[model samples]
Target: MAHLLHIDSSPRGDRSHSRRLTREFVEAWQQTHPADTVTYRDVGRQPVPHVDEPWIVAAYAPPEQRTPELWEAIRVSDQLIDELIAADILVIGLPMYNFSVPSTFKAYLDQIVRVGRTFAIDPEDAEDPYKPLLLGKKMFVITARGSSGFGPGERYGHMNHQDPYLRVAFGFIGITDITFVHVENDEHSSESLAASIAAAQAQVAQLVAA
Candidate 1:
């Protein structure tokens, strides 16, 4: 059975479009693949601590040379990386904040993208020093935005840092097989929101079935 790591980074809970869409996606996926297991994390509601100086040292230090204190500093990082490595598929709910991801999700990224764990940084090879370790994993990101026209060549496309940032960030860790399902116009009129939701639902169904 496939394993899924389901993460929701929306503070709005029930009112969050990304949250609802991700739930629907996972539910539909479960119905199709009943034996699949899911691990859930809500970083938006219960935020994780940001990386500190000690965390920085712990991440770059050699595993064999790390002291007990250094290990303690990266305990959460270790756990998060372990969970990430264990998952075959990742379904993340992302709500755009100021044209980017929430701080909570950023913190999660900082924790999981470890130097030696998720990737290897080699100063010797300046051309391709960073080698990603989390390979053969598929990612599906459901992004909710207040405004529309964030697609490529659109009016506000250049300002659309959310998905592009995500792609690069996750791609750096070897998860390049990523798909995005966007629900736009969240802060617009009721009709617009409903239409966005309906379109998102159809996309979710197709993605789950595929």
Candidate 2:
């Protein structure tokens, strides 16, 4: 059975749309795939440490050349990477803040996106030096936004950074098969928010069945 990694990055507890949707998605997923296993991470409540100078040094250095101190510096990074590598599917509850991901989620991304682990550089191939290591994985992002119009050619499309940034970051590690479900209009009228939530929940249901 497939293994799923469920991650929630919304600081708001029960009030967060993203968190609620992700929980619903996972519960539905488990119902269908009874044998499947799930691993959960809550970066919003317990944020991962941001990468520091020692982390940089440790990441860049070859495994054989790294000292005990260097290994210690990247211990948490290694654990995060291990969890990512072990999972076949990922479901992230992301809330947009100022048109981008929250700082805590960004920190989680920084911890897992590592060279020689998630990706590699090949000096021999000048045309394609960057190589993605993680493969055969799927990702589902449940994003909650304050307002709508983040789609392409929409009113605020030009100001949207969340989707593109996540695509590039996750694609860099070979997770190109990604799907996004958005719950928008949080700051708008209750009816608008309700409609968005209904659409998002429908999409989530479809995805789980697929």
Candidate 3:
């Protein structure tokens, strides 16, 4: 049975479209794969610590040479990485903020994407020095946005930084097989919001079944 890591980064409660969609996706997944297990992390409510000088020093230090204080500084990072390494699938609820990801979610990404853990650097190969350590995993991102037309070649595509940023960041660690489902038009009329939600729900259902 596959293990799933469910992460929600929306600060909103029941009103959050991303949060609601992610929960629905997980519930649908459970129904289909009864033996699968899930681990949940709510970084929006309980934010992960941003990287400091100590964290940076500890992250790059040699394991044997690291002192207790150094280890303590990276304790949360270690835990977050462990959780990511243990999961076979990841489902994240991402809400767009200023055309990008929320600060809390960015902090979470910084914590897990580490050297000698999620990725490796090879000095011998100048052409390709970076090697991804995490493999054979699938990821689904449910994004909520205030407006629409963020898809490739769309009207607001050039202004859309959220999807591209997520692709690059997750792809850096070998999560190349990523799918995104978006719920847009949050600031629009009720009819527009309802239509977006309906489309997103349908997409979620299809994805879960697949």
Candidate 4:
């Protein structure tokens, strides 16, 4: 059975659409794959710290050359990377904060996307240097937005950075098989919100069944 990693990045508790959708998705997933295991991380509530000088220094240093102080600096990063590598499937609840990911989620990303852990640098290839270490993983993202029309060819599609940024970031780490389920228009209309929710739920159900 496949192991799943579920992470929520919305600060809101009960009022978060992405959070609710992720919970629903996980529940449905468990019903279908009872033998599978899940690991949960609430990055929104218990946000990880942003990368600093010490973290950068430790990350670039070789494992053998790193002192205890350096190792300690990257301890949380090591743990986060371990969880990412262990999971075969990932489900993330993401809320769009000013057209991008929340700072908390961004911090988590900075921690996990390490050089030797998540990716490797290749000096031989001048055109492409970064080699992805994590492979054979699938990811599902549930995104919530205050406004609508972020899809391709839409009015605000050019302004949409959340989905594209996520795709590129995760794909950089070898998670090319990523799908997004979006719930939008919570600020303007309730009917639109409900419709989006329904569509997202249906997509989640279909994905879980498959």
Alpha carbon lDDT of each predicted model: 0.94, 0.96, 0.96, 0.94
Give TM per candidate: 0.98, 0.99, 0.99, 0.98
lDDT of 1 by residue, 1-210 (tens): 999999999999799999999999999999999999999989999888899999999888889989999999999889888899999999999998998999999999999988878888889998999999999999999999999999999989999889999999999999999999999998899899889989999999999999
lDDT, residue 74, model 3:
97
Ranking by lDDT: 2, 3, 4, 1
lDDT of 4 at 61: 98
Task: Quote the lDDT for 201 in model 4.
Answer: 89
Give the per-residue lDDT of model 4 (tens digit) for 57-160: 99999999999999999999999999999999999999999999999999999999999999999999999999999999999999999998998899999989
Score residue 13 of candidate 1 by CA lDDT: 72
lDDT of 3 by residue, 12-59 (tens): 999999999999999999999999999999999999999999999999
Better of 1 and 2 by lDDT: 2
lDDT score, candidate 2:
0.96
Candidate 1 at 198: error in angstroms? Answer: 0.6
Q: CA shift at 96, candidate 2, in angstroms? A: 0.8
Cα lDDT over the full model 3: 0.96
Q: Which stretches of candidate 1 lie over 4 Å from their true place?
A: none
Error of 4 at 47 (Å): 0.1
